[model samples]
Target: MLSLFPQILFLAPLALTLLRVVLAIYLAYIAWYLLSRHAEIEHAELPIIGHARHGILWLSAISISAIAALLFIGAWTQVVAIFATVISLKQLVFYKRLKEILPFPPSTCILLLCISLTLIVSGAGGFAFDLPL
Candidate 1:
């Protein structure tokens, strides 16, 4: 089973970049979903920081999408990685139970946290748009 997994050290940068892009899309989707289901979602006691207010959700979605775009283009890699790390940390701090969905379990949040940290340390690598086109 272990053989099926890629060598973490050898593929660290690519894995981190992929994880960052995946997380950005996931965060954007969650924001849009929360905004759409504000009444139902906010019925539970939510942290003020994680409130499902329209403005908050919209800003979250936009920011997450921007991060995703930056990650995709491999531009401002460190900055976007830091921003993602902050947002993920905020989610862990303020909204441990941000979702009740099946596919998006708590472990997913933890994985995102790890991914952000990896990107912050390893960076986007040679394939990044940071190089001349």
Candidate 2:
């Protein structure tokens, strides 16, 4: 295929950086939502973490927050992306029930999964702590 905008090809890194940031923000939103809902419910079953206790829910929320921070800063991006991928995959596989709990559409879960996989394959991109060796 012929190049439509070859001059802007160098900006690929920035695009990946944007993707990473966006994914980080979404993850943070999920964490916040989880925590807010966790307050209302004493116990609720969660995908990949069934029969959730109060402490488990809090731990999950904290873990998700940590992942979001790590992703936003682009530290250990591939590893973080791997964890994100797993979480999203779990959500996607259990989309029917997850939607009711998370209030996010299945499409959003699919998008999150795709973005996480992309980050895993592409690394942290520009302005990130991780540099390809």
Candidate 3:
């Protein structure tokens, strides 16, 4: 079998690193948006939930901010990625109702979900705190 550009294969881990950083940034942005504009979000019924509560939104924002920080540093990456995947899945499932509260659109949610799944299967890639056990 003939191969081309095999030398660049060593850098594959960096690609995962990049995905992690981007996903972290996106989560951070969502948290920030929720925190900054919580007051403006009108009361509405969220999917699976009868009605959205202000306190719940506040708690979610704070928790997401923490998750974003953990993800940015690549600490407990697989665990954090699992959380991210669940959040993204929720966003995708409730896009219609959540669109008003969330900053990004449904497409971005799908992308984030994909990234989270990758990190979960790949184990945080390079420059991460999660070492193989």
Model 2 weakest lDDT span, ten residues long: 39-48
Residue-level lDDT of model 2, residues 1-133, one tens digit each, is: 5689999889989998999999999999988887788755445566455667778778888999999999999899999999999888877787776556764787998899999999988899999998653
* Candidate-wise lDDT, in order: 0.67, 0.84, 0.85
Clashes of each: 0, 0, 0
TM for every model, in the order presented, reads: 0.67, 0.88, 0.87
Compute the lDDT for candidate 1.
0.67
Tens digits of per-residue lDDT for model 3 on 1-133?
Answer: 4559877888989998899899999999988887787666636555566564778778888899888998888899999999999989988987886677778788989999999999898877888887742
lDDT of 2 at 71: 93
Off by over 4 Å in 3: 1-3, 48-54
* Pairs of residues at least 3 apart in sequence or in different chains that clash in candidate 1: none
Quote the positional error of residue 51 for candidate 3 in Å: 4.9
TM-score of 2: 0.88
